[model samples]
Target chain A: MTAAAGTARAVWRRPPLIRNPRLRWAIYGGSLVYLVLAFASVDVNWTRVYEGLDRGLRFVEGFLVPDFVSRWGDIAQGMQESLTMTVTATVVGIMVSVPIGIGAARNIAPLPIYLACRGIIALSRSFQEIIIAILFVAMFGFGPFAGFLTLSFATIGFLAKLLAEDIEDIDEAQAEAIRSTGAGWWQVVNYGIQPQVMPRLIGLSLYRLDINFRESSVIGIVGAGGIGATLNTAMDRYEYDSAAAILILIIVIVMLAEYGSSIIRQRVQ
Target chain B: MLRLQNLTKTYRTGDRALNGVSLTVEPGQVVGLIGPSGAGKSTLIRCINRLVEPSSGQVTLGDTALTGLGHGSLRRARRRIGMIFQEYALVERLTVMENVLSGRLGYVGFWRSFFRKFPPDAVSKAYALLDRVGLSDHVDKRADALSGGQRQRVGIARALAQDPDLLLVDEPTASLDPKTSRQIMRLIVEICDERGLPAIINIHDVALAQSFVRRIIGLKSGEVVFDGAPNELTDAVLTRIYGEEDWSATIRPVDEESDDQVDDPDAEAEHHGPAEVLDRERMAGLS
Candidate 1:
């Protein structure tokens, strides 16, 4: 076989990659079986799906002819609550997370502090914002304060994790240069870590602010106070038009938040 | 005066980077450390500033004992010892002025520096240093935007900003072109001279080191094998330090012919014959 291949190489030759037909076939077959099992487990009810489609068409209609005039007062108040909660939570969360993030970064922090910060980040991130809001509402007796705390926790989890990762990836040589100058630990962070991660942190904070605003609207479902409560009430009373108005306002605000943050992110970068 | 006594460093991986090395530097003296890669040149420089902590030994800068000092005092001692890196370790996102001002981080409080409110005197000194480094107009430019040579200039200015008593330079010209390497070495020597600051420059190019430094210290296998003036760094001494490779090629000046061209056009125009013959004989003996 060697002599034949050597003699025939000038005509044509296959590259040295060996094909594995059995493994390829097994992968294809396994994917097909998993697809079938996933569909089987869905348990989608066709009759309910038809009813949902009908309801969805009605929702779309209501969305177009939203009852903005009648529920304007409630909608305006709820929006104000969400806006205040988002801003307050985001600012406080950022203030808290900067140090925590620094502590969490393995490259910068001591081992014990790094572990503790990691634990805090994990705990905050473990529960959904709604679950945390329910807990806070139960403890604090239902208000925008609960929503504020919930969003702040969520913000800390997200911002700290991302910022810490960014800090870990920064150029260590620059940090060493700072340290060699006899700068203290905080001085090293302020000069070394902060400059490298500032643009990313600002971008992340803006993004977290947008996220907290969205989450604030939803946390009101657990009596934490925002547009979600108004939305729930309008839905229960079958005031679809008023519900549509609240949703429209939320969509508009989120869109504005997204647009503004992107502009700021571009400038920062 | 700066002194390193019985300095030794063994990494966690058990690689002995520096082994019982001892040295001293007098004020305003520029000492060149030359060795093959991994012969502990960088480890020795870092040991001086305690950037890479020595496993055992004492590093005395003036009256302070740098070894075994706690975090706070180590930082205080580090402030007086300036360090330059091969990569020109400037914070890339910061402006040239900010990077230079960072040398005063040890002097300023966190709040004051955080708000970028360095003392007016520090600011003026940073400006003067930038001008001295010939980067006055590029003060507001970000460090990453500068050329390699320009960035290294900023690195030198930042080190000088500390008003350090001693400078620790690690492979200062390792990443530069021949012309740029000479320029950087010249700048370091001039600055060290003017400030009366002693400097230890870890260098790769032996000829450049000979041109700049007053004394040369050659290390082999984490030990100082040769310590004397540049004139004493003969081909045989280089072979002793770097081992049985092409020492003649390594020691022969790469571009000193250009230096003579710039000064005297006819001094050594026809003097390459004897040097070439000696180099060939050395190559034959080594083989």
Candidate 2:
């Protein structure tokens, strides 16, 4: 036992997980205190949870045999609307983002233009897509058009920020060479900036298209038009099987989109 | 004719890259600029086309004052001046043909170039330039797919496509093997001679510069240390430019005329170690 204790003592003399023992102790003590406080402040309604157990089981049971056929018309129309919104929003968003992205890159654009484009990106990114959809629905009277506008604005923010960062990271020497050829600003962008970002741009656009589709379903809960509206209505009417069917459809479509995007990205890269 | 008066550049970081340098080059005259690293060779070459904006200077190419020209006019003036970079600087993603055609960006409009719908004459000229640079077979190949020498050829072709009055070559052979460097230098000097286009080649190898250029300008600490005929770039002048080096030991032999100096058995015997070190250093620097 003394031999074993000596070996253990030698091991303990070595460095702890953190180099500083005091800091390590402080982190451990602080986490333990926080965990205790969190456990102490717990609140629960056991009776209510017990009462809802059967309802939760019934909701889970509906997934075993989803009624996809009874609500086929609603599901199909909602999916079509979602698809349209996704396509339109992604296309318009990409088109608008390209110029704004170029303008936002500090290496390329002048200061004022860079600042303004960045301001637009920040403003759009600051709000949630559903929030934007809500505001647009109030303005445009609730439809896929409002959803389209909301997703388009969100896509612009996402795409432009990534595109600007990609532009900024490209080889400045290549652009300098173009500029030295007496090329104008537009010509420099065409020959210099565009080629470097093309593959990434293609990949990002496809990814954004996938995202806009997912967001399209969410926006419909606010009556902005899509599969979410149908899913919400079915759930409100206690048609859990129909709601399950809608969710399965969303999952399948999202999976297909993800697979498609990966294939396209591989080809481009 | 090209002229520079008191060209100076003090960068934002307070590094004075070029200090009140002045020089002139007549039409069709090929001059080599020799200097150590950070000796303002690049700054001088870039300053000619106003790529590195001079804090205070006057750059007159023929009749136009290049230093004071606005964006549009500066670009127009830049069209007449072609620059070759050390790293080739060809757009890697573009094809050789497209990269070469981009040189004519000054002449063509945005939509035309964007669609790759260059005029027939421009296309033919680009082909001719490619043929001259000996890359006619690789026109469809992407720029990044090319070897170093081939890329430099594409760079040269692109520069030539601009139809520039003056060519500014910055360390054109820095990244090339010694033999490849010689070939590239030969090609550049030959092209310049054929077209009667005046050029300024910034080179590191003094031996190469001695072989190619009739006139040499040596810069040290951003100032002109020596300016004379290539024959005048002796061991003493090199010492003045590069500082504290045994010139006779490190200096590489030039052409047949310098055979006597190179054939010195005793000097070669004494400097063999330092020569190897210099060669290793040079190779390391090149890589």
Clashes of each: 0, 0
Each model's lDDT comes to: 0.84, 0.87
Worst 10 residues of 2 chain A by lDDT: A7-16
Candidate 2 regions off by >4 Å? A1-32, A35-53, B254-287
Question: Could you tell me the lDDT of residue A249 within candidate 2?
Answer: 92
Q: What lDDT tens digits, residue by residue, belong to model 2 across residues A1-269?
A: 86877754444465567988799899999999999999988988899999899888888889888999999999999999999999999999999999999999987788999999999999989999989999999999878999999999999999999999999888766888898999999999989888999999999999999999999999999989989788889989999999999999999999999999999999975
CA shift of A252, model 2, Å: 1.4
Model 1 agreement with the true structure over A1-269: per-residue lDDT tens digits: 86977764457666534368687788889999999999899988899999899889988888889999898888888888889999999999999998899899988788999999999999999999999999999999887999999998898999999999999888777888888887888888988888899999999999998888889889998899988877877888888899999998899989999999999999987
Could you say which candidate leads in lDDT? 2
If scored against the real structure, what TM-score would every candidate get?
A: 0.88, 0.89
List all candidate RMSDs to the true structure. Answer: 7.6, 6.8
